[model samples]
Target chain A: MDSELPPLLVLGPPAVFNIFKSQYPHKYRFLNAFSSDLPLLQFLQTQNTHPSSVRAIFCNQRQLVTADIIRSLPSLGIIATSTVGYDHIDTTECRRRGIQIATLGSQFAADVADMAVALLIDVIFKISAGDRFVKKLVPFKPWSFPSDSKLGGKRIGIIGLGRIGAEVAKRLEAFDCIIMYHSRNKNPSVSYTFYSNVLDLASDSDVLVLCCPLTEQTKYIVNKEVMLALGKDGIIVNIGRGALVDENELVQCLMKGEIRGAGLDVFENEPYVPKELFSLDNVVLSPHAAALTLDCFMDSCRHVAKSLDAFFSS
Target chain B: MDSELPPLLVLGPPAVFNIFKSQYPHKYRFLNAFSSDLPLLQFLQTQNTHPSSVRAIFCNQRQLVTADIIRSLPSLGIIATSTVGYDHIDTTECRRRGIQIATLGSQFAADVADMAVALLIDVIFKISAGDRFVKKLVPFKPWSFPSDSKLGGKRIGIIGLGRIGAEVAKRLEAFDCIIMYHSRNKNPSVSYTFYSNVLDLASDSDVLVLCCPLTEQTKYIVNKEVMLALGKDGIIVNIGRGALVDENELVQCLMKGEIRGAGLDVFENEPYVPKELFSLDNVVLSPHAAALTLDCFMDSCRHVAKSLDAFFSS
Candidate 1:
């Protein structure tokens, strides 16, 4: 192994982790926004010429990697990213190139599920509005009381019965929320009733949770049509992805009381707010932070470090 | 019973179906409020003269009815409130007066449990804080991320092992939190450990929930000593009563990090935030509205109505 060159190429944000960089600065090189263009690619290509070691590729959940970038890493043996979804990575190309790709699992399941639960309570109890009164740094605290709904004996329909969805079910069990889920494939072990239609699940559930992956089939799955079927007081919580809900339709339904309220962790576009969401007091919105936390990031670092260690050892 | 008057005298804020003088319009002849303590005892003596009607009395969870008041209601066969806690009603006085008292029971267990779970998520995930920044009529959508703290593999302690505590435990079971509990009397049905000392329970649990009733012995149970024993980063949730936690010590401990944070519904002095807690952001405070949901309260009304029907029929 070359002693002078970096042992790995990490493709992600360069947080100021003093311990990590100081201890192994020479062994790790970061490929951030500054290192992804044509000239930088040429420089990285030259850097990858050292036969004694390979560069390790790292990306976050959001970034898109190109085929050219994957091809350039001739010495790349491992691809690691801090996410459960690796759709951004060209898995087919990586398979052909003899590369081992590793991504995060449900390390954020409880956290995301917790966020979903938090949103459910927020929408139900008006936590977002209460928070506003707290922030104006208000002169007086509002006389906000508990709302009109309870989770118990209410049907909770969950879409995309994956890791986080299952975790939500398990947690809601304590609250006595009836579990109703619809997924493309049935999970026999889960014991939740299967609904043939997503709208059918929506119609029955008091709270409809969006946990499905972003695909053409599931796009705008909770549109105006679905919300109407769900009824006027029904709640919608989306923790999986933004595109799964039709933002315009959701806002309209909320305004007209076709659907009661929504707790949204994601939106159709990144860092943009739909105008209609602001008009309704029934919705609670976060900046797509369902999987962001200090603990989960710390876990991710450990996972990435282990994967890198294994790759080097191999 | 007189057809003109509402049968029950609800002593506090009324729901849509639950009629109380405070929330009722002035036109509503059936409801009336006593301002500045217009001798409710003396008035009840006069009202009870009509023993054929007004079979029961209802009060809000916060209303203070002294022993003298309970002794005055000769025809008050049943005293009911939509809460699990009955300390406000002077239950001893009711027992002495031969007045049967009833409160909402196991039906609201999951609802209260869900609130506890919601508060936990609110405190840990910073849900309230995040929403305020992102959607709270704020100038900018400050970049926010979801908190990633998984609920698996943490020791959780319940101070009371009653219906709500058991419900909370069952809900957390799927999340894999090690459940520990301490109550004066232990029930054999639960699998959780029965810790005798509050300090031991505080030391062992990652989260300590005060679900026990308020009694002279249980008052200020989570004082400075218990808070200190909890250590930094340990969480506390109070769904039982504010008196169960010492406000002064809790403020000091929270500021000093003796305990991590608190998710509180009840307060020693409610709606009156200790200036110290307002200064500190480590606590998530609710307006003692844990079990005051519309559905739960309505259910309580139906329960009381049914009990009244049966009691009167006999």
Candidate 2:
């Protein structure tokens, strides 16, 4: 019965495998790379079955599905990623091999947008700082602690009004924020003030939210000039990816108070944040877990399973 | 020339005076009590001018306008407070003496509501915990760190559907939250589900947010019973007043894990928080600073000045 089932290649960390295993339909048998004692390529080479039998690859955000992984599997027809961002996957390699890519498609947009606003408010209100002050023996001086500005009526510039960016714009609207966007093309459906140039957007905005994808054209988009344009009273919130901004420049800007503060969930290096940001009360840092909610994970799992099932059965 | 200007009595800490003094219209001469070496009552007694000369008192959130103070001023025509809640002022004494009372009238509603949503997201997503973990030497594990649920589609029961509560509802709606409320009366302006009974609201809600004013009837509204009904998966957010929930019961619930977590901006005691909560990761504490923003404070100063001017002119 197990032999009759289609073979699915499971890529990424063990955590993704655990979640995918629970939600995935039993129609496909998973060749779990994470569970193998040997390296992924060696484990595949040792598999008694033919490499062409692996019809699909299930990948998550944590692991990169490199070109080598794509070239190794001859029958890999579809790569289903359980996240909105596909920068971790070798998309150019997959395109060259004529592989269909299935993304979670804004399923986790609300979660990510919620975090963007969360970090924005935390920075503006010095919420985490206040929490630390209260927890610490330091006196709770309201006037001194949160002398920052309010969230309402501030001009907010959003990069890439895609699914996550659109969700962020919608949420900030409720706060009475003046929303503007710098996307590849101005969205005709919405009436938000459009800025074709990101530098212009940063210059006009009190806050800049990065929700765009990480691509060749977009890597290090928020460089020194953009940060300087944002001014000392401005803030930056990156929920998109770490490489979206020049991380070193960000740290320098924050340290010098050139840009007021930052609320970064993504860093240039994952799991490794700059030590300078640790002591700065103005900057709030999170370990890239914005879309790691149980609900989002479950949704992602089901979406990947459904997409793979559809591709195979068709 | 100074006597030509109407005398306006200023009360509260020196911080309030600093802000009040900046925006105050020159028409009124401030009898600044906060800067005086003598106590408030002693300061009043030491004044060379007759008590009848003082026509209006400007008080901020930090000070309490007691019955004794009201009795001391024979010509007090109006008391203007630079906050939404007037519980600090002796309302009963003002009513007896036919003295009018003026409040900021939801000027800080957006700021407070923004903080409410900020606290909610921080508690749910473990943004602060994630920051702490990253800042510390702990390994960044996505699945392990944020094992909590998402903010979207949660049944949030707002305790008061007033100005602040209304703003919270509007913001949460963008996150796709199902907002319910248990206010003194059902608000006709909103379409959210209304529960007249507090117990029913708590039982049905995954999260309970206290945004109502602290009053005689509303004091300790969330007691042990309410917490139990909210259950172990529940979260409490107090951006209103601290006394809205029984602080002892809340502390017990949090300790025992009777409820999941809390995001508190207000406490029963100002500047002093419970020592037990310092080590807990579930509770996020702030120093009663929901409305402590530069924009909100300036708006409040302007509002107080306008109201006082209008009252005297009328």
Candidate 3:
């Protein structure tokens, strides 16, 4: 085990531990931490630390991650984030370091796309909020309530054209909804048109979903300016990172009814959600759980373990 | 206006009103009701003091409607239900009355399909429960509550294969669910295999949705007998009619968990719920609101208006 290769370092997603042990066996020694924002810089940069022992740095956006952690892993030959979005990692630094980077395979388009459906339905239907009420473990006046808004014939906008965007388009086939998207390029997957800017997507969309990743090219994409353009009678769902949206802008839009509602699974501070966001009835907040499922967890773990096997075997 | 003839009578769903009113115009006066039930019959018997003026009887399965309604209306020439289910009209009586029984061409299929999808998700995901929790207008522990079970790779069973049943098939195509169904005749719509009886469908299905309408042949179909067959890991969704399933059987299955959960939108006695069923988190209840969209309301109203047009025009 020791002669062939250095140890593998998995730095995010607690679900990855079981996956690594099962898939790779006695391959690279795995260094995994339970929480995000682990003190990787301090831990590895200590005077006596051996940087040559690490081979790869695997990451996920959530779990309180910091970009500096990846830069400090001197022996990280590969940097992979389980999610399609990689803004959590310093990609420029990885590129400069000649790190081979990987995200999930392109076919996982449906994972994010299907989740977009789940979140969209969650927003329009107010599903998560409704579920909590019923689970009160008591019986109440079931029929005495306000009527929910229906999703039929509503307008929706997609803001990206990557794998996830195409899959979201296909699944929405029977909804009878009018579709418009703001993709960097026109996609041949569906007849959905491309809007040049986020403004166009926001202006007309009854439901505006952020599918684009958060990056220098796309960070704070849904700012106060864009939220103002979106106006009221609109809903937003961000399955991507919270940094992609300006928290201050979102709070104002929601408070002022500039946007009717939002369905957010990711947050600006995650474990420390803004108290105002929690109190809103129109918003459905989940703590960074969109990309999770029993299957996704197990599969991602197995993939990382397999990568560890290659690093050790070669 | 006096020269134009009143439109013939038709029985069935009220969705077919637009076509007849828009196309036939002043040429027809219509007689229409939103439902095929005992009240409609009692109303007709009282109204039709003489038969010579009546032109047709359009009807579906509900009341004991037959030759008597047609005989009472001697001028009756056509009968129709805006539904595929024709159990109420008595086709044999229509044949003897020399009445042309016509039903609406496109039926409640798309709506029912969407409802089934909603129910399947609701039953498993506890959507109604979620709706209640959200409506509470309370602060919730967002991070702690999970999305519940997922639909990927679960086995789903559908019963009945008429119009609505077929649409359920088309919409579930994107989900990675294994599909099976039970219909009297083999459906050529998709590759889903046929189950000869309810027991077979119950035995294999993780979720069992009632798509067949209520009838003497199908009444009390999902009794304690089928509940026993479903074992413990089953979920049931009923959109067909409340009478089709024995409510007691449902309560028992839920209490003992012979079935894992259920989502009920319609009931044997609706707008008046069974008090016993209210306390279970294993169930989701709505006031038969699946078809209660603005589109449905407008469509039903227009159907009544058009039928009046046809009746008055003639």
Second chain TM-score per prediction?
0.85, 0.93, 0.74
TM-score of each: 0.86, 0.91, 0.74
DockQ of each: 0.44, 0.64, 0.14
lDDT of 2 by residue, A11-126 (tens): 77534557777765577777877677886667877765577888898877677888987888888899888778889889899899999889988878888898899899888988
**Which candidate has the highest TM-score of all?**
2
**Candidate 3 iRMSD in angstroms:** 5.2
List candidate 3 stretches off by more than 4 Å: A1-13, A16-32, A35-52, A63-67, A125-153, A224-233, A251-257, A272-283, B1-108, B122-155, B176-179, B189-191, B224-234, B254-260, B272-283, B312-314
Worst 10 residues of 3 chain B by lDDT: B139-148
Give a tens-digit lDDT track for model 2, residues B1-314: 77788888888752445677766646778788867878655776676566778889988767789999899889999999877888889989999999998988887888889889989888898777766777772445443555557888899999999889999999999888999999888878788999999999999999999999999999999999999999999999999988999999999999999999999998887666898988777889887778776666777777877888788999
Task: Rate residue B7 of model 1 by lDDT.
Answer: 56
Better structure of 1 and 2 per TM-score: 2
Off by over 4 Å in 1: A1-3, A7-26, A31-54, A71-78, A90-99, A127-148, A275-280, B1-10, B13-31, B35-37, B41-56, B72-76, B136-148, B310-314
The recovered share of true contacts, given per candidate in order, is: 0.58, 0.73, 0.05
Q: Each prediction's Cα lDDT score?
A: 0.72, 0.85, 0.63
- In candidate 2, position A94 carries an lDDT of 89
Comparison by DockQ, 1 against 3, better one: 1
